[model samples]
Target chain A: MKTVQNNTIRNGIKVALWEIRKLVWNKAFIISLLLTPVIWGLFMGLPRLFEKIGEPAAAPTTYIYIVDEIGIYESLSQKVSDIDNLFLRKHSGPIDDLRNRIEGDENAGYVHITEEIFETRLISVMTGTGDTHIPLAFNTRLKETLTRYELAMHNVEAGDIEKIVAGYFVSVSPVIEESVDPMDRVRKWVPPIFAMIIFFMVFMSGMTTMQSAISDKRDKMIEILLSSVSASSLMYGKIIGNFFAGLIQLAVYLIYALMFIHFLGIPGLGHIPVHQLLSYIISPELPLLLFFALAGYLLFSSIYAGLGATMEDVMNAGNFQGIIMLLPALSALFISPVIGNPEGIIAQIGSYIPFTASIVMILRITLIDLALIEIVIPVVILLASTMFMAKLAGKIFRTGMLMYGKEADPKEMWKWLRQ
Target chain B: METLLNIRNISKQFGKNTVVDQVSFDVHKGEILGVLGPNGAGKTTVIRSIMDIIRPDSGEIRFNFQDNNNFLSQIGYLPEERGLYRDSRVTDILLYLAQLKEYPRDRARKRVLEYLAKFDLENAGKMKIKELSRGMAQKVQFIGAILHEPAILILDEPFSGLDPVSQDVFSEEIRNLARNGVAVLFSSHQMNLVENLCDRIFMIHKGKKVLYDTLLRIKQDFGSFKCEIMSEENIRDKFINFKETEKIEQEGLRTTIYLKKGVEPGQFIQKLPDNISIEEVTIKRDSLHDIFVRTVTEN
Candidate 1:
């Protein structure tokens, strides 16, 4: 009996080796691996490239039509002559007509400095259609010129006027104590982020497992293969093969991510406490994250493999098959809610549901530290669910692999499961 | 000859349809057993049952070997639906198949090269399956089946789409394998090929075994002498009156007469009426194709 089991395992590994060889040596697979870094580089570099390309060649000049009722235009223009892209033109026409004429002109606008500035100490700048607000350079120059003129009229000293116009120095300091340490925040965030990575990796790898089964059926190699090895072996081999393949792909992405973080100096990443974060991630909590991720992957991938077998063609998949394939996506819906309040009712329920437990538990762990029992219950549930799913998937795979020409209906699958 | 494989009282049903019913057969070493059946006659189902791809409702498939470990490794199957990974190279796919049978990788590699060379596919090894012609692909698939040099070979419609020359090549290879002690179970619609190659024949119709016997014995039982005559005169009645004439068919200027078993052509010719004017005459035994159609239609 042990020998038979050994043979089965050996055969499964042989099948796995074949699958790995096919995927690793495939030209498309290799190209996609290489393309990940190139795509990441493009994603990171495209905006900066566009920014450089978008820099203004030569700023368009704006003509400031000065409607001066007070004799301050000459001095203001002289004071602002150093500013590029700004030209002041004294207008002798009716102010209302000038304003009306330049209303729609993007490059021209008028500023009226009347004696009302002395009474109300207010001056208004009417902009044209092109300008949404008064230009900062022109406004600063006008303020400086008016203050000096007013100081001269009032017999105030130039030093006092300069001090009055000078910008004030103000500093803000928080009075409350720091709530969360930056290191603690990084340490808290690493597990959930790692969980998210594992979840996506499992999703990608599970898809490949499905594709592997579909291709075996589509290419009509399933029977020949089954004659050499059992159908469960074939299904398990695909899951195991794609699992490693997905890890290799994830490793490639990680290398690119590490390069980006190390070189690009992402905000907060540079100031993050790496040693503390690494220690936290390498602890027993890491095993919990891995346990859920692995169990979740096995559960979904087995079902995906069976779903692929029942399909006649990937292009025209049945509605039942499509629904089964979307089973993993249900786990994603619990992400935000569980993260919102880790101790809330939703998180508690989600952590117990087999489909959503892996992700929800990971998110919950990051938000709030849980007791030992909190982790143990979900782990047990996931392990049991995974084992049961694997067995059921084996039955479906055995029958469905031989079912040619048309997709297998749910009723037929139910019959097979019962058998 | 030793019976390397025995299947007894096998039955299979699929939801109100009996695909195979009470089927039993034995495949002996160093011989070819041709499984003859029409469309949807459950030939594939029986073969799949023997391979353990599906379980028969009631049957025992026993392989008489000293040691029964990894019995599947000893069997090689060529399914009716022939396929390989389209994106995989010929050598790679062959090696993978051999490895699946638990054949050593290094030895499988060597066997792959030898088979490729033997099939005239040496130069095409590096090419992907999609790049090969249909015949070439079929040859590659055949080589994949026999790469491990299995003890039992099951080929289902192995020559469905092959050209005549390729068919001859495959036929010769199968004969060579059988001569070297491999038990081969072949299923095909090509009766003439089966008649020429198979030592024994198993015919099934509508999920039941209609006929099963050695080729020579079956011919002796069902295949009697047939006589054809071409004449301008009405000679059908003349041939129909003979005691040895079992049946007669008449066409324009032609007549075919099936003689009863143990009846001699010379005796029948001597018994012909002298008034009949015959332009041409020939006599031969019944062909397997005729017997197949007759048996199926009768059943």
Candidate 2:
């Protein structure tokens, strides 16, 4: 029988293809790919849909027994009928008849009006308290109608009140940002979303990479795999596979988000210029960002891979994985502080730390227009750390993947790392 | 009898505990080498080192062929701790494993079907591993190891978790592979199968090599000038005066006695009590199983 040998790069690619096959072939993953967009559409599109649908239908009509001895509610009745979400019908009947009608089902409630002989006044509106929702709407509108009538009696104008509430009369307006950059509003809101997207990409892809390593270890396939190629080649293959899988998820989510903005005209998303965001993405700054993102994924995932190789099962892997999860969690923690003070000392320090660089650097760039040198510092650090992690993972995981039977203690792992 | 694979004083240490001591052995083309050890005897460690899954601390493992890299594709290793994707189809899993070994995708796919057919698992190609019975999974895993038609096979506890019938099938296939000139080195705690299947044997205890020789030579080196005694009475007290009694294992009505060097089997019968009712007397040569026990115990 003839033996075949593939170059290291080709073997790594094959391993990557194998890793990717599991994800693409999985029913749950495919279903999630389709379901996520639908969810995003629903979340983002629902409000705009309501706005397009316009005013809602009016509420159910109520027959009011207007005991108008003093004739105060005549104008109130006209205004209540005009209200879009309410309807009113006046009843001109005796007090006994009004009470009976309210006791019966023909009327929702009744308004009784009477003036004391000494010039004091008394008014009462009665409705069944069995249901609150319908009654609350009915009561609020009826009360508002009476309030307008009282205001009219006192010579207060409704148009003037609206003008006052709209801040037209207020001389001062609050402003947050100093610069008058037209894209300031867009930049302000979009960065948190961008930072969160980076965190999600790094965390999820790192998990996939870790799980792949743990899987081979669990299946004893690494032993078989090592027979054909080096452990480093196998690791590179998995890392490459996970990178592509992450890219696919990112693309799908981005496309759905753009569609959410483009078609649904979601409020904040609609204001963002599509061409501008696209241009920024493809700009020269993109390669550096891409480098940071790739390196961050490798840095975190290699740590995960090393830990997972030493673990016996998914549960054990999760324990170490939870510790590794602190990278994104800590990045998320740093985000609020970094965004708050984009150019502050905390942000400056966080932007250079490899684990937090992917998140904090993106936040710093978008929140504040960082200098070119400042941006390059984090990118270079991330690049260097990524190379270091790749080497360390090769050193640690190769031996960890092969050791069996007993739990992987720290001392043994240290020895493996040293070796 | 050309040397197909060679190991030279290989050793591996995990932490401070040396799992595989300075061990050495050779596998010949068309030969079967049985690695025998009790539990935690570093059998799997030695096998893994030979496959280059784990690097040795102080020695080199070399194949007879010129291209050591090329020789890698010619090895089929079934680890002692074995599994396949429980949720994946049999065909996909096999194809993936073969492809990782540098087998051509199309050829691997086609060959796997033929292999499945040979194992009477044609219908199982579409089935997930979880759906297969224990024995069926064993057969499938065995097929995975040999699917690439590797020239050298290293199987660690290959008979484990198999039904008797599957074990028999594995034995036959292993012999068939050897006859077709595939060198086989398999480790097993099941001595009978190893005795019946392997041409030569390598035994280790506590990470140290105790014995390594041909099956006949191992038996010759540790002869059985021993007798099996069946009696209702305890035989330990009877052998107290017999200076030739090397070791005595007494359980219920059976007493197996191993005699020291130069002791005769007939001499054991003469030492027995005349008043006791003895049911049987059998004298025999040492088995590979016996040699394994003696080697481990004596060392």
Q: Write candidate 2's Cα lDDT for A27-108 as tens digits.
A: 8888898898898768776987988788655555555556665565666666456544444556676777766656745336
- Error (Å) of candidate 2 at residue B211 is 1.5
DockQ of each: 0.67, 0.34
DockQ of 1: 0.67
Q: Candidate 2 chain A: minimum summed lDDT over ten consecutive residues — where?
A: A128-137
Query: What is the per-candidate TM-score for chain B?
Result: 0.93, 0.87
TM per prediction: 0.85, 0.77
Stretches of candidate 2 exceeding 4 Å from the true structure: A1-7, A43-199, A268-280, A313-321, A403-412, B225-283
Clashing pairs in 2: none
lDDT value, residue B213 of candidate 2: 90
Question: How high a TM-score does candidate 1 get?
Answer: 0.85
lDDT for each of the candidates? 0.87, 0.76
Instruction: Please state the CAPRI-style docking class of candidate 2.
Output: acceptable
- Give the distance in Å from residue B284's predicted Cα in candidate 1 to where it truly belongs: 3.3
Cα lDDT of model 2 by residue, B1-299, tens digit: 79988898989887789988899889999999999888889988788777767778988798987566666778998877787877789999899888877678898988888888888898999999889997888788888899898889999889998878878889999999999999999888888999899999898899988888988887767776777889988767777667887888888899888888777777766777787777997877677777777677787
